[model samples]
Target chain A: DAGVTQSPTHLIKTRGQHVTLRCSPISGHKSVSWYQQVLGQGPQFIFQYYEKEERGRGNFPDRFSARQFPNYSSELNVNALLLGDSALYLCASSLERDTEAFFGQGTRLTVV
Target chain B: SQELEQSPQSLIVQEGKNLTINCTSSKTLYGLYWYKQKYGEGLIFLMMLQKGGEEKSHEKITAKLDEKKQQSSLHITASQPSHAGIYLCGADLGGSSNTGKLIFGQGTTLQVKP
Candidate 1:
């Protein structure tokens, strides 16, 4: 089966702009989570949705939000982006809320 | 302070050598996961350990979760150049109800020389 897939493998945005990243989970998966990885650092949790509902959120600012669809696809949106927002946005999916997750190639976002 | 800490920010070893990487958590870990990532690529899941003192292996890679559940280690026997990548350890500290939100450590980058 195909693994988690993310869209727009890369993106470039300006400060104060908004961007949306998309993710399609593996078939039969019901959980999708978002993470941001800065250069040379590991990923940091952003948001997690299970069965189309928000289950957990990390320490990210209000500018970051995400939602899962009935089909288990997800979108992560960041508003009023700042240069600091530049990073690799990764989407991960699992069979359930707490199971092992597989990640996507990630959307590389660069804000200037 | 970082919730998860990984030792040896980077490693370089000759092929056929054995090396170990560690992940320590300040809080009790509900689940510990190991993943590998090449530059500009997605993470490749290696192993997951939930039970304390649990140990699992795949080929030449072995992962162990300490009895205390707060420490984990990954050992590679007869390392090969294919093992070169960023090794990351992710921890779930939200208990049983966690929804897959993971706190990851600063990855340990490994470089294997042939």
Candidate 2:
């Protein structure tokens, strides 16, 4: 089966602009989570959605938000982007909550 | 303070040698996960440990969890170029519910020389 898949493998946005990244979880998976990885650092959790409900949220600002669809796909949106937002946005999916999660290739966002 | 701490920010070892990396948590860990990532890429799941003193191995890699001490270690025997990458430890902090929210360490970058 195909692993978690993400769209727009690369993106470039200007400061104050908004951007949306997409992720399609593996078949049969129900939980999706988003993470941001800065250069030379490990990923930081942003949001987690299980069964289409917001299960958990990280310490990110209000500019970051995400939601999961009935089919288990997810979208991550960043508003009023800042240069600090330039990083790798990763999407992970698991069979259920607290299970082993598979990650996508990630969308590299570059804020100019 | 960082919730998770990984030792040896980076490692450079010759092939055929063995190396070990550690992850220490300040808070209790309900579950500990190990993942590998290439630079600027996504993470690849390696192993997960839930029980105290539990150890698991795959190929030449072995991981052990010590719940009492809130520490975990990853050891690789006969390291190869393929083993080179950024090793990260992610943990689900102990709480009333398992939200699947993982807080990760700064990561340990490993470089193997042939």
Candidate 3:
């Protein structure tokens, strides 16, 4: 079991630029959710996708979006980034809506 | 705004001691979950309490939810260095329109020194 895998372990971008982080869910899992964790804070839910369709969205602005691919991989895209966007982007996978979740190491995004 | 509030913001204990962290929510939760996170790491789900007055135990940790449905506590017995981490409590509202979306507390950082 490789667990959930997130790409671009760390990234740096300037304000107003756009960045896309990716995640590969655990094998045999079909639900993926994105969360943003600022320093010294608990992660805040962002978006959720299951079976290639969006299941739910959090309080994040419209500038943040995500999509789950047919193969159960997910991509989180953030546009018009601000310094506040600098945080750890976490991806969690679940077998289905009814089960517990497994999280990845997360992608650290630093916006200057 | 976060409806959930966690207590003691941080705590330090000697190895082998016991520690308790608390979580309180303004709205009734259909479910409450506890998670542990090491420094700069992802969250590890510890336990989930769904019904009021529910209690669950896992290894050295025990979690209890009050009958009022407004508060919960996580108690770790014989804490070890491996148990040092941030403890977070989250609530699932289980609204008619949403089920899994959770509201998290600020988290309590636990440090166990040998």
Candidate with the greatest DockQ versus the true structure: 1
Cα lDDT for residue A107, model 3?
93
Poorest lDDT segment (10 consecutive residues) of candidate 3 chain A: A94-103
Of 1 and 3, the candidate ranking higher by DockQ? 1
- Please write out the lDDT profile of model 2 over residues A1-112, one tens digit for every residue: 8999999999999999999999999999998999999998889999999999998899999999999899989999999999999999999998878678889999999999
lDDT of 1: 0.93
Candidate 3 backbone collisions, by pair: none
Candidate 2, residue B107: Cα displacement in angstroms equals 0.3
* Local accuracy of candidate 3 as per-residue lDDT tens digits, A1-112: 6999999899999999999999999999988989999999988989889889998899889999889898999999999999999999999888886567778999999999
Q: What is the lDDT of residue B28 in candidate 3?
A: 84
- Residue-level lDDT of model 3, residues B35-61, one tens digit each, is 999878888889988778999999999
Question: Between which residue pairs do clashes occur in model 2?
Answer: none
What is the per-residue lDDT of model 1 for residues B24-56, given as tens digits with 9 covering 90 to 100? 997898999999999978999999999999999
Per lDDT, the best of the predicted structures is 1
What share of the reference contacts survives in each candidate? Answer: 0.82, 0.68, 0.45
TM-scores for all predictions: 0.98, 0.97, 0.94
**Ranked candidates, highest TM-score first:** 1, 2, 3
Chain B TM for prediction 1: 0.97
| Alpha-carbon RMSD of each model | 0.9, 1.2, 1.7
